[model samples]
Structures are given as C-alpha cells and as structure tokens.
Target: MSSSNSVEGSYSKRCAACKHLRRRCAEDCVLAPYFPATHPERFECVHKIFGAGNVARMLKAIPVQERAQAADSLSAEAYWRVQDPVYGSTGIVIQTNQEISSTQCELAKIRAQISMYEAQMATEQQPPPPGLPQQQGSLGSQENMPMFEPNDPFNFLN
Candidate 1:
C-alpha cells in the first residue's frame, strides 16, 4: 500500500516560468517558490518586464537569502514599468521628492509663524521703559513718589 501510494504520489506543479516555457521544472528550480502558479500574473508581469533569462541571472547572482527580496523588487519594478513605461520607478521617486519638498516648505512657514508669535509674546511680557511714569494716584500727588523695590521684604514706611 505504501509503495502504491508512493507510486501514485503527485509531483509538485511547475513554476510559472517553467510552465510558460514548456520546460521541465527541476527540484531545485530557483524561480519555483517565488513564482508559484497561484500568482501567475505576478510572474507574467515580471517576466514581461525582465525576460526569463534576466530574472534567472539576477536570482542566481544574489545570495540565496536575498533572492526573495530581489524577486519582490523585480515584481514591483515590473508593475511600475507597466504603469509608466517611460519613467517607471523614477517617476515615483520624483513625485515623492516633490511631496517632501512641499512638506518642508509648509513646515518652515509654520516655524516662522511660531517665531513671530514668540517674539510678540516676549515683547508683550517686558516692563515699560524707566523714563515712562505710570499713573500712581487720582490726584497725581504720588506721581513723584520713589519706585518701590519688589525684592525688599521689609516695609520701611511701616
């Protein structure tokens, strides 16, 4: 029964590239796991943008641990290429830079406004000039009185 089961065991389906190429998928095929048959469109886009040979070469050039990341990058690049044939990812980068510049300009404007407000507050909080006499009494008799010292705790008049 085990022998029969082993004999009847199904072989894993070929990856997108192998299926598209009508070639046998080896056990250690590099593109198999990344380009599974479930997401054929992803592989199709990647394959269309970067040819199968180029994809295989890229995957082979990178270390095994980095292959998945490389595949993801390739897929994103392929998608962007389909969206913008002329500029692709460069268009995205440019748009992002413009957004950053706009945000920085807004931030600078806000900072300048804040600085102006702070300056106004500082001026508002300052004491009037010494030469400018404030009203001391209704009859103006106390106008000529000596300035009170806030730091003197003992009242000499008392």
Candidate 2:
C-alpha cells in the first residue's frame, strides 16, 4: 500500500506544464492546479502560443483566488490563437455581436408586424359610430390607424 501510494503521488506531482518542460512540479507551482498531468495537450497548445514562462508570470501576477479563472481564460485565448493565427478570438467576438444585432433587428420587425396586425383587427371589430358609412377593404379607413414603418438596419429610411 505504501509503495502504491508513492507511485500514485509521484505521478500526480508531475503536472502538464512541468512534464512538458521536463522539470519536477513543486507543490507551490502556479500552473500545477490548472494544468494537470492528464491533459498535456492543453499545456502544449498554451505553451506554443504564450510560452511557459509567460504563462507562469501571468498566473503569478493574478490574485491567488482568481488564478483559476485567469488560467482558463489564457487557455481559451491560446486555443483561439491556434485556430485563427491572425484574428484570433476577437474575430469570433465581432462575428457573434453582429449576429446578435441582426437577430434583434429581425425581432423588431416581427414585433412591428404584430402591432400592425393587432391594430387592424381592433379597427375591423369595432362598429363605426351610429351614422358613419360602413368601412371597406382590409385596412378600413387608414386615417384612424397609426402607420408603423419597421426600421431597416441595412437600408436607410427615406
């Protein structure tokens, strides 16, 4: 049991960062908790992009409590850098923002249509006073209902 525990302890001690660098992992090693031995590939990708020293420095600079979040963010940035050498994560962020804006624009248009439909329905259901002529057509007399022009994001309203 003692021998098995020693072997397990030794194996667990070699974190991905230390293993990749061919160095022993110290108990106080900042990267040890974030980059464990199980995922060497994660360390390799981060090392390739940010270098081991830079990562160590970054981790050390951050507050102890926030180090885990910082490490995860670094990992994500490294992944994005590997995927897109030029634009990296910023390109994906911009694209996502544009998509959100487009969806919001579409939603606005749909809401405008719903409002128009509801107004039209309301006018048609109500009887025109006692002496007024019976209104004809889908929109009845357009004078009563307010016109709604859906704002187009792509084209300017003239």
- Please report the candidate that would top TM-score against the real structure: 2
**Model 1, span 1-158: residue lDDT tens:** 98766534423377887777777777789999799877888888898899999999999999999999999999999999988999999999999999999999999999999999999999999999899887656667765777767667675753
Question: How many residue-pair clashes does candidate 2 contain?
Answer: 0
lDDT of 2 by residue, 1-158 (tens): 99999877876689999999988788788899999989988898899999999999999998999999988998999999898999899989988999999999999999999999999999999977898776688779878986556775554554
Score candidate 1 by lDDT.
0.86
Residue 125's lDDT in candidate 1: 100
Per-prediction RMSD in angstroms? 12.8, 14.2
Clashes of each: 0, 0
- Compared to the true structure, candidate 2 yields what TM-score? 0.68
Q: Rate the local accuracy (lDDT) of all candidates.
A: 0.86, 0.90
Alpha-carbon shift of residue 12 in model 2 (angstroms): 4.9
**Consecutive 10-residue window with the lowest summed lDDT within model 1:** 4-13
Candidate 1 residue spans exceeding 4 A from truth:
1-12, 20-24, 61-65, 133-158
- Count steric clashes of candidate 1: 0
